[model samples]
Target: MTETLRPPASVRLVRIGEEHAGQRIDNFLLTQLKGVPKSHIYRILRTGQVRLNGGRIDAARRIASGDLVRIPPLQVAARTDEPPSGAVDAFAERLTPRILIDDSELLVINKPAGIAVHGGSGLVLGIIEGVRKLRPEARYLELVHRLDRDTSGCLVIAKKRSALRSLHEQFRENAVKKVYTALVTGAWNQKMRTVDAALDKNVLQGGERMVKASAAGKAAATTFRRLRAFQTATLVAAEPHTGRTHQIRVHAQFMGHPIAGDERYGLSERNRAFRQQGLRRLFLHASRLTFVHPGSGRTLTVEAPLDAELQSFLERCP
Candidate 1:
């Protein structure tokens, strides 16, 4: 029996210019078919609806100049079942103390722990989506940087593509200064320390973003300077030189001082120890962010005062 492959989606590769020369087909669609959901894109790919050079291609496949992309007719919903207007309104209601700074070009919010920066998988809402409701007229609001779901602190939002792209360039050049504060188990030998490790995804075969240390992985760097000492832990300022996935948490684990309450990269005994101290979530927070303003071009430093939970922990430390 012959394999019954679905008829390919037919599309023409139009030469817009030299700019769209090297982008993948899916990315090209994301730009071209703006406001279409990502779920729809993946669905089209799985159905063999998109073809390049008369062959099916995955979303990750890159396209070269003069290559034709055949996009199958997509069955799209006329109305996007977006989050309710009231849902967005409620989200804004909660961002009371969470706002750090806001301007025409950017928005800085103090993202709370336990919620993701943006929705992925089962998460229905995130920091960015909530912020979008406040300024619905803006063309785009992209995250300049990201923090883990359990890590809370100053999160940056760029209003326009130019600012977003420029700020990204700054991060690549290491002009952005990011500082995090964490409570780590066991410490006190080095006044300052740097953790250099390579991280690879142990991907759990199917799970997303779960990674482990591997020599074959990307180089990760994190520097730590002890700010204060505790009886069983230390409060330290962590500067991640390279923004690998879980760089700080992984480095702390490598140092044998996994962040207190970090179940994924932490020890049971240490986590239990902090649980007694009232430490709940992963004890990490983006404390400070410094960068040149994209609009004014003046040096600007923004700080998110630690939430009540972290502040109380510090005060009670003996």
Candidate 2:
């Protein structure tokens, strides 16, 4: 339930470093506040609750190192103790059999390709909720990074917010290594190739997400190495350099090898062919991720193998 009256959350200013001095207000807020809902900040900006130099300023205004900002008070909701939904319970049950690795600071899993990382739409709760219920003493676990709802593979979860922050920094700086495996349509003659494409987003009527090639979009680049070529499909190992939304999937489509069973940006004929071969979900999985540990500063690497369906599909592919 929404709080009828919100008291106030204090705002403070920390001088930006030389590198971030001219960042926009919204960007600065996102960096500092971390978890505040975007809509709430946009509303605050619209009402002129955020100020610069003792006067209201646009949310897009670039903030420099010495600039002062005043933020009005707000009623922040208390954290609730509601139990997660029944689906989360089911998802938790599934996760119990699928956990690949775990540690004091993290939970690593090979998420099946079809299941979402978390809940939405009609979903009551996500993996985190299920994980929490399963390991109740694991009070502070959080996702270090997100894999797509339909894409499967190794997913990282931080045990605490500090660890989460450190990991987020690592991702932001592109210091982590991520590798995805997929069955793409067509026989790729290129043993190795790099595809660079920009992504532009379009939101559907029911909030279905789509992306396209556009100059106005972020620079997305991915490198692919063909591991094995089937008669009609190729299994490729993909390494994305810049983590734009749907970068790997879009780049694969650009190569005319839309991942088999991928609904978005995939050819229906290829999808049908994949289904004929007994694939149910998109033929993609995050197989591995390597990074320096947030707490120990040691290099930490994790891998999730293809589930039974993918393993069987590869075996049958001629």
Candidate 3:
């Protein structure tokens, strides 16, 4: 159903909902006033044109449910192009089978490798955007966390603002449990389980991010437990204590046993050998996640089974 959206000629009042509570005012405005320039949004906020509960609030102020939001009149541009027919239907069809868990507050999907979590950096549509396009009826949807394009596993999405805030807090406090399975070159001893290293992030000329072990960087740690052993490779479960960029992959490299098929950090020789062994993508999969349900207040553990290709490649590993 297409509803006409007219620019408010004067100040407009918006009532916050359960799905939008605890979100910053600026972010809320960005979604509500789509296509409006960021500069204009901030200008209105800076000029005290935007208010929360009858009081002027900063852009970072979190608005709660039932809070009255004052938004000044603003123009929204018209769209130039419409999506092709059945585009959203086709996208939803492709993504529906990947859903592992879906509730009013949370969405968990077994994300496949080679697909980004969200669109950016030259890509048009990503998992989140695709979901939004497909589920036009959804009032609120946002990514709770991110996984690399090459990483496949249980990725979580928040269906409500409360869930998002709660999940973010859990991640920040390291209360959420995330476990990944990776095939790495060389035999890993059970004794070498923990890797305490500092990681520094750098941006390349092309705007790609590169993370390395550095003393001056943020603290990162990973605990690896050997799960299986091949002649020249080992399958291990990696648990990252700190959510730094590429922490698990970088820690695997630091241990002299880079993950197989990790093009960014793996040795070319081992990668070529793995490729010959039928490894087509990075051999890292988010196997399990444990956390408290934001809505239920109960501990929940979700698991994603290994993809067919990864299992096939493991079988080929001699």
Candidate 4:
């Protein structure tokens, strides 16, 4: 499809719907006015050119159903290019076999490492975009949560707006159970344990936020169980009680047994040793997820088999 820019001529008023309720004001405007630059959107909001129900609101405000948004005239440039027809077909072909579950309300896929969940920050293609291209006839599709670019796992995609909202509620309420399989350096003596710590995210020199364990940060907790022990590395199952940025990785590090191949928070010497032993990607995988289906209230447990590469590396371990 060709990208088109709408003319900046008149003021417009849009009424919110249940589908858009609780969405950030800025995000809603970004979707409504697709071609506009994000900076310009913030500028208009700061200047009070955008109003909610005739009242000024900050960008952080959550819009509600039935609220009116007064949008000011603005100009925007079209996207430089669209993905080629062949690219769409190729993406669909690559992702189709990875589907783990597909129901009326949800689509779960065993996401491959190296592909991001959504496109942004210089990424040209992502799983969400690929799925959308593949299912153009589908009315709605959105990511239920995010996984690190290099973390392979069972990723969920909601098939309807109601499903999306319901899933988000479950996440917020901490009713979802997520389990991960990780290989960490050194022997894990504990059969079962919990790490309770507060984590803070700090933006560094180039605008990347790094999460660290700090007393003044948000509370985070994770439970880990030893699955097996190798000569130099131990395999464990990690269950996070509270979802925070880098909670599992950081908690593993806090336990004095940083995950193998975890360059961000692992011991460099151990990482080099693992690399020499033929390990490449981080030894972490979203092994399983247990939750009640939001649409049907049925108990569901989804699992993603470990990737072949990780399995091979483990076999080579002594």
TM value for model 3: 0.77
Q: What are the candidates' C-alpha RMSDs?
A: 6.5, 6.8, 6.4, 4.9
Clash-forming residue pairs, model 3: none
lDDT of 1: 0.75
Can you give the lDDT of residue 253 in candidate 3? 97
State each model's CA lDDT, in order: 0.75, 0.74, 0.83, 0.83
Tell me how far candidate 3 lies from the true structure as C-alpha RMSD in angstroms.
6.4
Cα lDDT over the full model 4: 0.83
If ranked by TM-score, best first, what sequence of candidates would result?
4, 1, 3, 2
Off by over 4 Å in 3: 1-88
Candidate 3: tens digits of C-alpha lDDT, residues 146-225: 89999999999888867999997898789999999999999887744899999988756544568999999889999999
TM-score per prediction, in order, is: 0.77, 0.75, 0.77, 0.82
lDDT tens digits, residues 206-229, model 2? 445678878888788899999998
Query: Which residue pairs does candidate 4 place in steric collision?
Result: none
lDDT of 4 by residue, 1-318 (tens): 112234246887787887776566876786777666555676788789999878999775777778888889776666665578898689877999888998899999999888888654445578888888778888878777778887898999888878877777777678899999999999999899999999987656544547999999989999999999999989999999998878899999988999999988999999999999999989989999888887888989999999999999999998
